[model samples]
Target: MYPTNIKMKKKDKRKVAKAVRGAIKAGIKENIKLFLNTKKFGRIILAKLHI
Candidate 1:
């Protein structure tokens, strides 16, 4: 864990945010493949979710 007096620098914060975004993007991409293979009702739900 980080020390109480220590803080994450701006650059490190941006890097963490970017990594998180990439992971989320990958997860959504995987889900999209699964959604495409699902039934019509599942597709409608997926579309409603804006994915």
Candidate 2:
């Protein structure tokens, strides 16, 4: 993946964008799951209650 910075053909533009978006979304999902295992979610709930 190091060479992903290389120029991609116009025909592959959408495909590459889709792949990058999919990868970023997947990474975010993983981080969210990991965070939920800690007490970060409790803080969010407490803040909501205070409001």
Off by over 4 Å in 1: 39-51
List the candidates' TM-scores in order: 0.61, 0.55
lDDT of 1 by residue, 8-50 (tens): 9999999999999999999998888697758788777777887
Clashes of each: 0, 0
Candidate 1 CA-lDDT value: 0.86
Task: Residues 1-51, candidate 2: write the lDDT tens digits.
Answer: 466668878879989999999999999976865675477785575557653
Q: Note each model's CA RMSD in angstroms.
A: 6.3, 7.6
Off by over 4 Å in 2: 1-7, 40-51
| Clash count (model 1, backbone only) | 0
Best by lDDT: 1
| Highest-scoring model, TM-score | 1
Candidate 2 clashing pairs? none
